[model samples]
Every structure is written in C-alpha cells, then in structure tokens.
Target: MSNRPITPLLDKVCCPADLKGLSDDQLKQVAHELRQEVVSAVSETGGHLGAGLGVVELTVALHAVFDTPRDKLIWDVSHQCYPHKILTGRRDRIRTLRQEGGLSGFCKRSESEYDAFGAGHSSTSISAALGYAVARDLGTAPEAGVGDAIAVIGDGSLSAGMAYEALNHAGHLGKRLIVILNDNEMSIAPPVGAMSRYLNRLYAGAPFQEFKSIAKGAIRHLPEPFQEGAKRAKDLVKQVTVGGTLFEELGFSYVGPVDGHDLDQLLAILRTVKTRATGPMLIHAITKKGKGYAPAETAPDCGHGVSKFDVATGVQKKAPANAPSYTKVFAEALIREARADRKVVAVTAAMPDGTGLNLFAERFPERIFDVGIAEQHAVTFSAGLAAGGQKPFCAIYSTFLQRGYDQIVHDVAIQRLPVRFAIDRAGLVGADGATHAGAFDTSFLANLPGMVVMAAADEAELVHMVATAVAHDEGPIAFRYPRGEGVGVELPEKGVPLEIGKGRIIQEGKRVALLSFGTRLKEVREAAQALSAEGIEPTIADARFAKPLDEDLILGLAREHEALITIEEGAIGGFGSHVAQLLAERGVFDHGLRFRSMVLPDTFIDHASAEAMYAEARLNAADIEAKVRDVLSGATAQAARRA
Candidate 1:
C-alpha cells in the first residue's frame, strides 16, 4: 500500500452504480485517480497498459452515464478492459492480472455480469452489441434487464470486415445500437489499411471542429416537434466531416470525433446517446494511447504490452536472455531465406511485432505486408501472392489463424497455392488464456488436403523449418513454434532444409517409445532422463511433421516398443490422432500394443504460465515420466502373467 498510488475517490466506488452517485465534476476526479490506479496496477502485474490507460475516461464516462449489466457495454478486443474492470468491482484482484487463477487480460463473459461480451479477438464487439440490441427489442429476456447495447470498438478494430458487416446489418435493421469508435490510432502495431487512413482524415480536416455542435444538436436527441432544427443540423454535418459520408451511407447516424480523454465531453456525448438514441449510432472518440503516463507515451508501441516495470523509470525487469526467442530465430531464418530468394515474402495480420515480422520488415520492407486486423483478408491475399508465383509466408498466430480457416481451405489448400504458413504461438500461450492459446491450428490445418503441417522441436529445428517452408512449392505448407525463449541449442549458420515427412531419432531404447511434437521434445528428453534413472531407457523421437506422419519411423517404433505414447502441444484430432489413425490402419493396435495420445484437455485451460498450463494438461516433463511409468508398469504386470 505504501508504493500504491492514493485513490480516495476510486476507493469509494465498488461498482458502476456507485459511479452514478458522483457529480459530473467528481467523475472527472475519479477518471484521474482511475488512470493512476490502472498504471499502478499494471506496473505491478505486467499486462496491457497503454490501451487500458487510453480508455480510462471512456470507461468512467460509460459507467457514470449508462446503467451497466442492464445496458450491455461491449469492448472490442477488450485488452482495454483493465480500467473498466477496476471500476466494476475487480480492483482488489487487479494486480493478479494474467497470472494463474488471476483475472484475464481480456474481457471474459464468465468473469462478471458487467462484462457483456467476451472479446479476445478484435472486431467482434459491434456484432455482439447488435445481438444484444435485437434480443432486447424482441424481448428475449426482459427479466435479464438487457437495456441499451453499446459497443466501444477501437479504430484499429474497424479494419476487419465483420465490423462493417455488423454496421451494414444494424443500419438495415434500424435497431437502436451504439458503436463508440475509440480512435487511438494504434492497435498492437501502428494502424494500417484504408479504415486507418479514413479515420486519420476524419481528424485531419478543420471540418471536425464543427462536427460536435451539429452532432449534439442532431434530430435524434431533440423532441419530435423540433423536426426543422434536426434537418438543419443534419445538413450542416453533410457540409462538413466528409459529408458525414461513409457511416451515414451505411445507415448509422455518425457522431463526432470527440475528445475521448475529456471526461466532460465524453460524459456529455454519452449521456445524450444513452437518453436519446433511437437507432444505430457511431461515436468517434479521439484519445491518446498511454494518455497520462509519460513512459508509455514516449515508448515505442506506446507501451502496448509491457513486462513488470518500475513506475519511476519505466524500465522493464526482464529476465537475463539465456537463449534467443523462437520468434527471433524464425525472423533471422526468414531473413536468411529472403536474402537467398527475392520471391520469399511475408504477410502478417496486424501482428508484425508479435510474429517478429517487424524485424523481417526492417530488411525487406517492400516484401512484407501488415494487413491490419483482417485475418480473413490476409489469408486470401497471401494465396493471391502465392498464385502469382511469389513464395508467400503467411505469418499469423495459431489462435488468430482460426479466423482465416475458410480462406485456408478454399483459397490455399484446395487450389494447392504453395502458400507457406509461419504459425507462431503454436501451443498453450501464457497470460492471454484459452482465447489466445494456439491449441487448435494443427487439427484445423492438417485436416485440409494438400496442407503440410510441421512443428519445430527446438530453435535449431525452427531455423531448419523456415528453410523447409521456403523450399516447399508443391502445396500449402505450415511450420509451428511456441512463444517465449528456446531450449538454448546452437543455431546453424544457415538453415538447411530437412527432408519432408520424416521424424528424427533423438535417442534409441527399448520397452517404451516417447514420440514428441513441437517444443515438448525438451520435456520428453527430461522425462526420458528421469525414466533412465529407473532403468527404463525409453526410445525418444521427434515427430517433425504432424500431417505427413513419418510412417516408416512410426511403424518401426510400434514394432520395436511395447508401449507407444504420442505427445503434442495441441488439441485432440491433431498429431496424436493422425498417429493413431496410422497405427490402427497398419494393424499395430491388433497386436495389443499400448498406445496413448497426450493432448490438451477437452476443456479450455485458463490463464496461467505455459509450464503450469502444460502441467494441468498433463503434458509436462513430470507428467510425461508418470504417463510412461503408468503405461509400462501396467504392461509389465500383464506380461508377467502371460510369461
């Protein structure tokens, strides 16, 4: 408490209802205190700081003006929900963010009733808020008190096609919905695409200076009798602010590019919208990312995401780098490949930094594409590039890649377009939880015909896999690697492409075989070492390609070993399932062979450290050792009776 910022006003507020008691001036004070509290909490916990900081005033104004839980307030890509969470009675656990058993970094529906919709991925909020509006209009649950449905979406989130789809539909349906465009002009990476440019143009012109007056005096807010004043206001809007064109053309009554950090302006705008809004409306709020904090404002990415840092200096206390991250290894390997082949290009869906393609872009700016938050577009765009003869590596996080599945199947896989997918965060990612976990890409991608799926065992393997993806031109090929630092293996000076559809023998032994996939080979080796201490030298192999399933190696392992256990950092119907299908087809299972497939649990694992999550899934080193022992002990007892 000594180090904590004093928040006298914020302390009095337990929920949004408490905010309603405060005077408008008091609400401004609360916003000030709340920003400090958010910065202080995030400084201790190390989660998304700048986004939450930016929305401090918006969060306060929304809660102060509208009746929440009753009025569904949806946050698009709710990484900005930390301040919202603090105001909605989650402040005590605020410092526990992104930790095991702690609050989620994003808005979760189950976390609270105040969290109207769960949003991990961007551009879903408008759709959800529309659903709430329709449901309320139709009186689906009057007892639930579903009132005004408001979606607070960032301008960056607007880049996705879904937001516009929802906008178009809401306009056509003519439902009373509120879409607050929180335009900070930054979403993870700096904004991209036409939507970003259009938003900038909205703020750039002097026309915006007159938009607030016309917007505030618009017909919707006035009584039905003041019809002439409303018409005049509407005409004035058309004369200014791009003729109130795009959003107005879409059916939504477009509101101002208001000052988002101005508590008074936000309160005035929101109060008007809440009380008088009769149809779909879009409120454009201009706010600064890292609004109050000097460290975040000056830092690159505006401190989009940060490690636990000192409040005074803003210097992060990162662990000593023992090994380079897998992202770095992939970036360097891709750079090497790009150096060799000019056609080797990259595409990322608003995650150049997250996917390490920002590093790639530093060297090959012309070849790299940051397609904003539009994953579906990114996938098909890469397919177009591949069809045109350039070797396109569609680098995307495994979780986000789910958005582009239809494109992958229809455009890349079916067409045999030879598009390389550099799938990062390919396993249970820490902090972000089940919503952001890369747990299902293998199952999804491998199921597609002509799609080659491979997972790297270590950083060196990742280097080789990058080379392999660059070389593979037969069909669509993908290589997956998890988040964080590697196993400290020495990287090759240059990546040498590995033979396709082959598994490598790490160590050869007898009774039991441990077939590992992805970065779990590190754990498999540790388990093998522990087993060796007990006089059980297990056969260890790295199943490099999940889709291809090195048949010869798998068959040989089944023939030689008494028990075969397949391990992967993926869900069911992935690598282990493919191996099972192979063994069953070969009639290996008919010989009473002990087979077990280690996968992520059927349930969604919550936010935790990657190691802890793996342990919960029972795919950790100790868990592997136990599983091997359990399989062998049971097998040995049964064999003794047969002997």
Candidate 2:
C-alpha cells in the first residue's frame, strides 16, 4: 500500500464499459496507468510481474474493441491476466492476489463472468476458444449469447502439440475466431525448440518488418471482390521469407508481427479485426515480456516471477533461507553423479531454473536439454536417450509431468526404459494453489508397472534419492521432493544409494505406529513428540519407496503395533492407498489391527501459505496427533467393551 503508484486515468475506469467511452488519446493514458497499476500491484503481491506488464496495451485494446463475456476472451495459462482482471471490474481485489480468501493468482471461471475460461497450464487457450466458437455456432452457448471467441496465447505455448491441433481444427471449421499470438520471445525460461527459433526469425527479417504496412495498404486498395484472394497471396509471399507460414499452412489467415506496446497500433488493428469478416485469424503481435517498466524490462526473465520488492530500486525482498533448498540439493547431487558418470544427461520441459537444471547446465552444458514448453516431448525424448544407453534424467515438476503421463506409461514404463525422473514440487505448492499441486504423481506413477516412485523427507534424503536415481538403471524410476527449502539437516560429503525397497525407522515406540511417505515425516515426528508428552510414545518410520511398499517395515509395524496410521502429502489414491492394499493382502485387517490412511482431502485446497494449506488439508502436526489419538482411543474403548 505504501508503494502504490498514482494512476489518475486508471482510477476512473471501473470496467471495460468505462474503457469504451475513452478517446484513443485517453486510452493511451489508460494503458500507461494500467501498466503502472500492474507493476504496483505485483510489487506488493509478488506474483507474475513480467507477463502482465507485457500485455498492458493488448488488454486495453481487446476490452475496448470486443464485447467481453459475450465475446469470450481466453488467456492462455492466465498468469498474464492481472491487467485483464483490473480492467474487468476486479481492481478492488487486485492487491489480494495469491492469498487465502483473496483473489486467485490465475484465472478461475467461478471468480467472475469476465473470466471466460480458467487456466493454469499453458497452451490451452486456443483449444478452449475453439470450443467456445463451436458452441456459439451450435447455439449451445446461448445463455451468455456468444458473439466471437478470441484466444490470447503466448509464443512459447505454440510448442505444445495441443495448440497446433486446435489451430488445425479451428481452420477447418472456418468459424469466426481470433487468436492473438503474443510473441514476447519468452516463456518461464527463454524459449527452446524449433518453434521459438521460427518465431525469432519472423520479426528479425527486414522484409517481414516492411511487409506489414505495405500489405495493409495493398489489401485496402484491392477491389472488394479481389481483397480476400489478394490478401491470401500476400500472406503466401510473406510466409516464404518469414515465419507464421506454419500457422498459415494449418489453415488460418495470419496478420501482424505488430508492436504490442503501441496503444494506437493495437487499438486500430483490433478495431479493424472486430469489424472485418474472419475465419480463424491469428494476429501475431511482437512484444517485449517486461515492456513498460525499466526494472523488469532490463532484468533477466523480465522479472517473470518476483517476491515483494522496493519499487524504486527494483530489488526483491526475499526471506532468508534456513537450509539448502531441495532444488539446489538435487542439482548439486546430480552434478556429483554426472562428474562420476559421463553417460548421464539432464532434460527439462522449459523449466531449467524452476527444476534446478540450471545448476546442472553450468556443469554439463552440452548434456542438458531444455525442450521448451513440451512435456510430452521431454518424456519421450528422455526415453529415447535411455534407449540409446545414456542415463537421461527428465527433471520436471510433478504437476507438469501430468502432461507427459501417456509417454511415461507407453514409452518409458512399458518399455522399461532406464529414464530417471527428478520430480520437483511434489506436494501442495503455496500461492500457485490446486492447479499446480503435485498431488497425483505418486498415485499415477505408483500404479504403472516397472515404475519406481520415491519421495524425500528432507534435504539430506533428497541427495541420497538423486544418487539412488543415478545408480539404479533398472527401469523408469522417479524421486519426488517438495518445493522450497528442506528441513535443516546435516549434509553428507557424498550421497550413497539405498537398497531398492527398504525403509529406515526414525524412532521406536509402543502401541501406535505412524508410517510416513514423504516430507510429512517432520509433522509425524512433531506429532510423536506431542503424544510422548501425554505418556503415549508413538513409533515413526519413513516408507521411502511408495511403489515397492517397504514390505518388511510396514508388515512388522502392523504386527507389533495396536494401531497403524499411514500419512503422505498426496491424494487418496497415492502412498497411503498403496500401504493399505499391502496390509489388507497380508490379512492384517482381519486381526482387528486399527488402520487409518491420512491423505489430502478430496476437494482442491485454494492458494495460501504452505503451512496454512497443510492445516486446511488436515495434514499438520496437530492434525496428525489428533488422528493418532482418535484411532488409539477408539481401539481402547472397543477392547474395554469386549472385555
């Protein structure tokens, strides 16, 4: 609040309707104010900064030109929707982004009517927009009275196969759809793959740059009957020297490479497109990711994601780290393994920094491969590398790996390819919320045959897991670790691999046993301490491998303890479910051994701090102790009644 910038023009605009009343000159002021507001809001909230700043003029133009809600404007990934949110009557709640009971960081359909589609994952806008277009044509979506469906997508998102698939269908249908390709030459990481290079070449050529005005002038002069054909011919000529030919061939009329920051240009072009007849038109607008603000514009990644920072200095206020991050630990461990093994290589799906592959890339530059925003390709590509006798570690976030699941099952698991999966952010991530939660990887991967799944309890254990992934070339193996820093533990000089299916006991106790699968071991220990203070010393053990089921340790605990509780930081069908199946098959339940599985609740928990989210999920230390008491007390009462 102290750092909020003055936005006199932006203050008057409550909605898109207010924006329509402004003149072109006034709109320019609004755009400038909007950019300032976005920077100020993100400086306070510390969410996605660069993307929103990039699309300020485009947001203003789209709202001004189109009849929203009816027109159905969809933002791909929707991380860049902050500017859109402010203009669409959500300005009052803009400061509360990514906080509990506040506005979501990403778009949510339930949040507002202006939010035409909810999105977290990238490259989905075009597909959803095509659906809207089809629905409008079929008269199935008459409730909102759809007019046009416009998909605003980023350049990096074009790498995904789904986008192309949607484009192909949209073109074939010949429906009135508008796709604004916001080519900022950046995704999370500076883009990778052929598509990025193609986009780069599009704006780089001098001929393509000159063709924009020339083609527009030529098309306007052509006879009304000849205009359509002449425009296609010009597009074909432009495609020969520049990019967008790929999109054109897929069957859409391509326009621009327009300057995104120029409000006059954006407004004129958008207004023209809104009036003209179109069959799947793609407006390729060239933009700088962090356009308006100098601090973000100059910064690497354009301040893609930031913590709360000083506005004048542009220096972020980051919390001091108490321990080594799980990401860094994994990276260093992988570097160690790569030093020993020349055959090892790393792969990431456009998230080198996010997954800690940036550290590995520094060590083994040629060996690291970033496949851009293509997770499916990353998985299958890793499988191919493994097939070629190279140890390929596909370092991907657990939530992102969901996109590559089919490849995991078909290419790696079925073939028993020795691909190592370094699954980062394996539990409920704070701020990013349910859309990004790594809750289902454990459940999905554990069920796959020849797939080995492991989760680290802390930093030191993560090192060992990395080593384990390196040494074990048996099949497709994955090790998951949560986001942020580890639970401060002493580090070993080097990690040594563990036995395939073995688990180690943390503490020995009496009547009740608490079996933990992932980072929840810390909470289990805290719960155990609380129980001990009350004269109940509960046993705790870490089930390192959820897939293999640490049979000896789990069965032994079931046999000796009066009641056993399994806890994991995943969904219902994950580690706990696997443990229960193992116990039931062993006839442990028939002997009246009270068993309970603690997992995340069925509903999706919203954005909040990690501790608060865990509390909401009932997976905190207090909840753990309560569950143990409930199970044990119930068994004690039943025994007394029987006696």
lDDT of 1 by residue, 398-464 (tens): 9999999999999889999999999999899889899999999999988888889999999999999
Checking candidate 1 for backbone clashes, the offending pairs are: none
lDDT for each candidate structure = 0.89, 0.88
Model 1 score (lDDT): 0.89
| lDDT by residue (tens digit), candidate 2, 108-185 | 999999999999999999999999999988989967589989999999998898998899898898888899999998
Backbone clash pairs for candidate 2 read none
Error of 2 at 535 (Å): 0.3
- Superposed by TM-score, candidate 2 places the C-alpha of residue 387 at a distance from the truth, in angstroms, of 0.7
Question: Model 2 TM-score?
Answer: 0.97
Q: After superposition, how far is residue 340 of candidate 2 from its true place, in Å?
A: 0.2
